[model samples]
Target: MQTLNTLRSDARAIFDAALRAADPRLAVERVLARRGNHLLLNEIPIFDFTRGKLTVIGAGKAGAPMAQAVEAIVKPDDYLGAVNVKYGHLARHHAGVISNSARDGVRAPTKFILLYEAGHPLPDENTLRFTHSLLSLLEEQTENDLVLCLFSGGGSALMEYLVNGITLADLRVFTNELLRCGATIYEINTLRKHISQVKGGQIARLAQPARVVSLVLSDVLGSPLDVIASGPTAPDSSTFADCIAIVEKYHLRETFPPSIVAHYERGARGEIVETPKADDPLFARVTNVIIADNKIACDAAEREAQQRGYAVQVVSTTLQGEARELGHDIAARIKHAPTRTCVLGGGEPTVTIRGSGKGGRAQELTLAAAIEIEGDAELVVMSAGTDGTDGPTDAAGALADNTTVVRARALGMDAHTFLENNDAYHFFAALNDLIITGPTNTNVNDLMIALR
Candidate 1:
């Protein structure tokens, strides 16, 4: 029988291997090659440029690699326009057009534009300006063109554009307030869709008459099209009423924008437009295909665990709720598991920020697990965002063993106090347990594994 320490180490190795296996670039290429250059969703090929010209207009953290894969398939003459991508993920050859500059591209058919490397988890002026240019590019499209939209996670922040009468400053304030208030990504995007010009199926509407094929890399729980990057190129099932209800539920009426308030009021009265629905005509010519999701990553992890001689059990692939509570629950389960047993879960978790301390969902989950796990059950827990970024911190997430609790206590660190202050980043950083991978160039929400 393997010792607890050995089991923990094995689980960590499996988790890391799983993440690498689910790389966005690799997934895009594999899925593309498997389905061929033209992907079909619901018997509709996403792109049929045999007659008209093909163009690419997309925005997301994984947009660069996705573009590279598409470029490999399409003819040079058939490829038109640009795809906005997160900084540092651009291919070497395509890096010439955009070089991490904050300026937007004006040139038509621009191949590579870095646009800006604004802060993550929050949008900035650069994010707004670049997004405006992206929308402008869509407006340039004619009915003879077909738009290949490469959408992935982090697009919501990368493509921030406020509706008329709303200021970016207001958005920033509202966004910061929501983060500090510990709102879920779903709630945050609902509010954002209500205030944005290009979110919640508006992009699909803008590209009307011109066909759109959205190649999506899902990063949200359940892989809902409407929640991934606020579903810019997909129809929205949520409404302004849903947005208003979320704000009121969170008691954010005081901080809510007056213009936003008016927009919702007008929308409620049918004076303003609502987002396109499932049966809307705008999506008649549009198709969205999910190229990758959390289940793929979890399956990879399970395979690695089984290969390593561990009995692997996938607890759930759509886990949700408070990170800390989930962490404790996982720890408790692992404590009773027999040796060489691995439990896995994948999904996004919410954080209700009561602490002023800096920490992400993954960090908080690891800290909570550390406190609940004890003895030489050798219980090991690992949780991380598939994108290699967790919150505002550079660390992907954190890993912990039984000794983590004692180690923190020896340093005068109180787990409950640290958690209360929302300071998991500092606490985990001190112990050198932070999993820093910079940008893995993929986003599929979060993954967790416990080995016992």
Candidate 2:
């Protein structure tokens, strides 16, 4: 039987392997192939090397890495591009190619491409500026141009072009309500798609005459393109009616920004232009493909577990719902796993922030799991975001072992009290169990691993 430390190490090993297997580098390389004169995406020739120029633009957690891969494959003189990633995501690199200067800082980017860093999970003023720049570039392209769009998670907030009538403050308040209301990614994006000019196939519209191709690293469950980063380049199936319904379902009208509500009402009433739908003509020259997602990470973790001589079980790849309650449920699943077995899962989970806590969903779930598995000596579990930062906290998540409960009790900390207060960051911090990896330069959503 494996010892407690061994289980912990094994679970982490599986996680690292999972990240490597879902490496944005590999995903981009596989989907994009350069032929003699044409650029092929999964065997479909989407760009001509000999004819038109290529304009690459993207925004996401994986933006830097994906752009680097594109630069490696394409010619420097003919490619014009840019990307918007979260801060620190591209500190060492940017849109062109990352090379260190004599001063040990990233060399300045070439004139052809610009890499801008912005906010994530929420957009700042910089996001507005960068989004407009990208839109200007795309909108200026001619019919002969090929636009390469590399997208991943975090793109939504990092790439925003506010509608003309809406104030940034109004959008901010509206976003805060959607987050606190426990809406799924789909629901949240549904509203975002209707409110923004860049999302919900507007990028495709902006790049109308140009042949556009989008390579996405999906962070949404089931790899739905329309919901990934609010489907900036793909068709939107949601409507203004759906947006109003979601707002109503969450009872957000009172606190939800009146401007946002007014926008949705106007759009629903056909007084304002709607987001491009599936039948829109803008999709004629567009191709959006998901190159990587959560299931790939889960599959890789399972393979690593089996290789390590553990009886592996792939419970689910699209886990969802509340964080703390699901923690108890996952704890029950781990408890039933036989000794020397490993369990792997992946998906985005939500935490309702009723308390003024500092932790993300990953930390909150593990804190809840700690409550259910208090005394066993050989079990260990971890729930971490693949992007390496959970919520606003520095922790990617938390780790729990059989001794976790007692250790906390000894420190005069009540796990239940913390969980209720949504203070999982402090709880795990006190126990020295918070997993900190920092910005991983990639985002495929959250991953959870359990060993028994």
Candidate 3:
């Protein structure tokens, strides 16, 4: 008899395989290569070092390793700039980052670019500072320059520059409102572009005349270029009217600050310029390449599941909707699924917070699934973020087998009460069921796995 513990281990191994496939450094390395006096991305000659000065800039959770990938191809002396990453994401690249002050009056010679740690899920003080640093670097570039931009999940918050009249405080509040209302990443980023000077192709406009190449690791479902990191280097298909429509759809105007409401209103009235459109000549110099995404992660999971001796089924690559709802749907599927089978899924899910609870979409979904599949010995389900951090909690997500509820009850814990409070973190913590892989240093979205 195969125990749930064994199933859980297999599921975790499969998840780990998915993370390895989505590694930001490896993803960039696969597409980027160097040749004698020339550079190639995906085997096409894209850059020539002798033509101009090379400047690298970007923002994301994977920024540090992506920078390391670029460094592997471009000499540190040949390129210089900065990238804003979420706080504590600079894994093992401490020697490569330029610090604020030199303790010994000598900076590391290998340090050509600056990596500034900033707040995430929302922009903070360091976000503003790093944005200023990157813009100033762009200001020094001329027609004979090459700008390489790295982007991945979390870049929207890791990098930001507010448009005039919209304060950081207002932007933070507006972002929180959008998140709590279950707004999609596309809609949230659409609104972000309107209020930020550096997003929605504005960065490309700023780097004009200089050729810009952006290597993206997509976290959004469907990988719409304009929505990722609010399309800092891609054309914006969304408009101010789109922003207004999103607000009206969510009834967010009432909760939003006056400045936010006024800014988009002015933008719609032609008082402010819209984000760069697809026809904009500025985009002629920009190239956005997706190096990795959820599909790649899910495919890896499928292969691993097969290697583990389970019949595999890829459920979906574009999964969406509310977390709790998706949880129930997944549980029902697993219960009806054939024995010795592994069902794999990938996509970002939304969590609409109704209580003062500490949990992300992945954990919330797993909790709901646990309740639905309680008392069934033939199923085990796990959902986790590839980035290794779910929402604000330290745990990436959670793993629940048929034994989950029973184990919780033995410890005097109730799944329904925790679910009601949106407190999945504590619920899983008590049972030691949380999948805690701290900062896998990459993001392609989330992965859901079930085995029976």
Query: Per-model C-alpha lDDT, please?
Result: 0.77, 0.83, 0.87
Q: Which candidate would rank higher by lDDT, 2 or 3?
A: 3
Ranking by lDDT: 3, 2, 1
> Cα miss at 57, model 1 (Å)?
1.7
TM-score of each: 0.91, 0.95, 0.96
Model 2 misplacement above 4 A = 91-112
Residues 68-113 of candidate 1 have per-residue lDDT tens digits of 6765555355455555555554544344554535464433123433
What residue runs in model 3 are displaced by over 4 Å at the alpha carbon? 93-110
- Rank by TM-score, highest first: 3, 2, 1
Which candidate ranks first by TM-score, i.e. highest? 3
Q: Is candidate 1 or candidate 3 better by TM-score?
A: 3
Per-residue lDDT tens digits for candidate 3, residues 148-204, read: 899999999988889888888997898789778999999889999999998999999
Lowest lDDT 10-residue stretch of candidate 2:
101-110
Clashes of 1: 2
- Model 1 lDDT, residue 243, Cα: 75
The better-scoring model by TM-score among 2 and 3 is 3
